[model samples]
Target: MKQHIRLLKTYLKPQRKRVVLLVLLLFGSIALDLLAPRQLSLFIDGAEAGASLDALVTVAVVFIVLTIAKQLVVAVAGYFSEDVGWRATNALRADLADHCLNLDISFHKDHTPGELMERVDGDVGVLSDFMSLFVFSVLGRALLAVGILGLVFSTDYRIGLLLLAYSLFVVLVLRRLQSVGVPHFNALRRTKADLSGFLEERLTSTEDIRANGARPYVMHRLSEHVENLVRRTRASMISARVFSSVLEISLAAATGGVFALGAWLLPGGSISLGEIFLIYYYTQLLSLSLIVITHHLDTLQKATGAIQRISELYHTTPQVRDGEGGSLPDGALDVTFDAVSFGYGEASRTLDEVSFALPAGETVGLLGRTGSGKTTLTRLLCRAYDVDAGAVRLADVDVRDLRLADLRDRIGVVTQDVQLFHASLRDNVTLFDATIDDGHIERAFAELGLSDWYASQPDGLDTVMVNGGETLSAGEAQLLALTRVMLRDPDIIVLDEASSRLDPGTERLIARATERLLKGRTGIVVAHRLATVRKVDHIVVLDDGEVCEAGPRERLEADPASRFSALIAGGTA
Candidate 1:
């Protein structure tokens, strides 16, 4: 509950004045409702005394005006509540995105993208409703009930006492029931998030599911999840609804008792006919308030569950960040790794005591087996993840000392897996940067040997690429990714077998493009193909996450003791 209050403060702090205004308006509305019964009682007494028609008309007009004002205030409060709710949701979503992007790589590895999406999107949506409805419903009704009870008690003690007793009983029972059912409803929310994540994962992989003839299997899993959600929802609804219905029935029975007692004591003049009517009206208002408040209590429960999930993402801190007062590097670039060691959680170290130095303007090849930590080393160069021990140096400064944007800007990467968003070809190449030069785009395509294919597209640069680059073949997507790096023209190049996806003819084009792209810039090529690696100025063989051999490509290939020599002989070089 404290956590929920703190979370709500973020929403309320932005609209403090509006919240105060809403409270004042609602108080006025409640005052009007309480005064309505008093005015009617006065009119009844005046009519019995044969008051003038003009006096009655005046009272009636005042009643109508007050009712209209009350309704107007309610409408305004509703509008403002919705606006505040939406703005809070926007703030929450933006903050969640920032946190998700900055979270530790280990967090991302543990949670699926779809699950995180459900937390940030689906869960936050529930909070929007809670913000808009919870306060308005609960506070407004509670105030109304208190005002009416006060008026009723002032008019007649006997009837007010009976009504108050019944109201307290109903509220206590309903609150207890709500408390018991909250945990169940919270469980229901978790199941719903799971359902959403499962559907999202399956839908995104629909092609693979169908191709492998696992449609029935997938459907069975989806059906089971849905059934579980339905069962949980049904049980929660039944318990809450049953408790609410029983409270209403008990209140009705108690109302009958109040009237009977009032009648029995009527001759003694403890209560009157008019006071009975007022009590009935007050009881109706109190019951209505209770019903609406209870409904939103359920909503509040769900929202709290959602807030818990969103808070998980909000609280996560990134493991890797810039050093104190970091800034971009300037001038000639040199990369050095000093006894750097790293590992995924609980797994064997992927890179162990690896030390290396590459002077500016040198091409280096990282030769290794499938799990030899080649890609991990490249990620460290970009500071994608910080090392577990030791330091990575760029231009004699620790990599962490450089601003993230500055570090990423100075390095260009093309990995084996190419991911393209759903956008125009030009957007993918320039990444929607407004200041990219047109000449750079043109030259990038030509340098990557993709100018002819790009020109043949329906709209050339403006042509739309479908989601995940599904419209283009795998090799074409790889070329587009390469063209993207070419346009950037960074000081350092990291190519993780970007040409492996292409055909033999396309491979030759990529090789020529690679040579042109690497000129006068430091490069790290992680490749399995012998022909592709042979072009680099130097090669370093990696085994079990350590440097095993190092020399020029030809010298390493000639040495029988070298791992690269063995890999070449095995046709996996």
Candidate 2:
């Protein structure tokens, strides 16, 4: 409940004027609805008294005008309500997206992209009813109920007091049932998210699944998820049915009691015929008002479940927080790893007490077999994960003391697999940044010897890469990736097997581009090919998570007993 109230204030506070207008219009419409009952009672009394036809016509026409005005006000109020809901939820979606982006990479590892999408988009969609209906329509119904009782009191206080107690009883009962199905709905939502994640994972891996003859296995797993979804959905539906049945019983009993009392009072001239009719009519109106609330109550349970999930997401603070330190020094920056130790979750250490350094304007080649912490080293340098022990420093200043944005801005990373978005080549190169001019991109392609490749495109940078650049070959993607890094002109460059994807034909082109890229920057090359690391100033060899050897590349190559020399002789590096 507190979370619900907090969300309401956070979103509704921005649209103050629309909210006020909606409230006035809604209450005005309710006033007209309530007055119609009174007008009906007046008509009944006038007919009983044989009042003139002209007088009756005037009252009838007034009632028709009231009805029409009420509809117009309601239609306008609905527009405001929907507009407010869409605006609030869209803002919330943007906030959620930004928040998720800032969270630790580990958080993303636990949740699939599809699940996150559902949380940010689908769960918030459920709250549209809560935001639009709960904000004003719920209150309008309550006001309508009160007005019904007020008119009844003017007719007769006895019925007024009885109906008030009934209203309270219905409210209490319904409120209790509202929470009864929320737990089921929450579980149902989780099953839905899991289903989405499963589908997305399978769809993305379609080629691998088909090539390996694992389509049958995939379908079996999908079936299991679908079965789980059905079970949870069934449970939620049963709970809702129970809630609706109870509401129906309460309404039926209340209506019967009102009619019975009105009949008893009509005898012995205690209340006039028109008075009985007015009481009955208001009682029916009150029942209809409660029916509206009952409908909202059902949606409220679903929205409550959604709110619980969204609140949890908002409250989740990231482990990696921005530092309060000053900006890093300009120009090429030396990189340092001092007795660093780290692991993912409860797993054994990935980089254990490993240490190395690259002087400014120099390059170090990292030679390591598989699972030797080569990638983890680069990750630590980029501050993707903090060290469990010791520190990663730039220019001898601990990275933990630097702002994350500034730290990352000065370091560039190029990986074997490049992720391209479905956008124009220019947008992909500049990452949708309009600040970078076309000349800079063209220059980058030239520096990397990709000018011919760029020109081959039908429309140059304006050419849209279809489906995440699938049209580009593996070698072409690497060329584009190198050009992207060169454009950034970072102080430090980490190439994690960046050339592993290039064909033999593009090897020299990539090598020349890499040499140019590392000219004045501190560079760390995680290499599997000796030719890739042969030109580096220094070499660091790793076995397991520890650094086994470190020295000047020429000296290490000269020493046959060195680990770097042994790896080269064995054709491992």
User: What TM-score would each prediction reach against the true structure?
Assistant: 0.91, 0.95
lDDT of 1 by residue, 292-411 (tens): 876776676677678877776676677787666455455437888899999876568899999888887888888788899888999898887999999988778788887787888889
Worst-scoring 10-residue span by lDDT in model 1? 323-332
lDDT of 2 by residue, 173-207 (tens): 77777777888889999999999999998898888
Candidate 2 local distance difference test against the native:
0.85
How far off is residue 297 in model 2, in Å?
A: 3.5
Candidate 2 residue runs with Cα over 4 Å from true position: 468-470
Relative to the unseen true structure, what is the Cα RMSD of model 1? 2.7
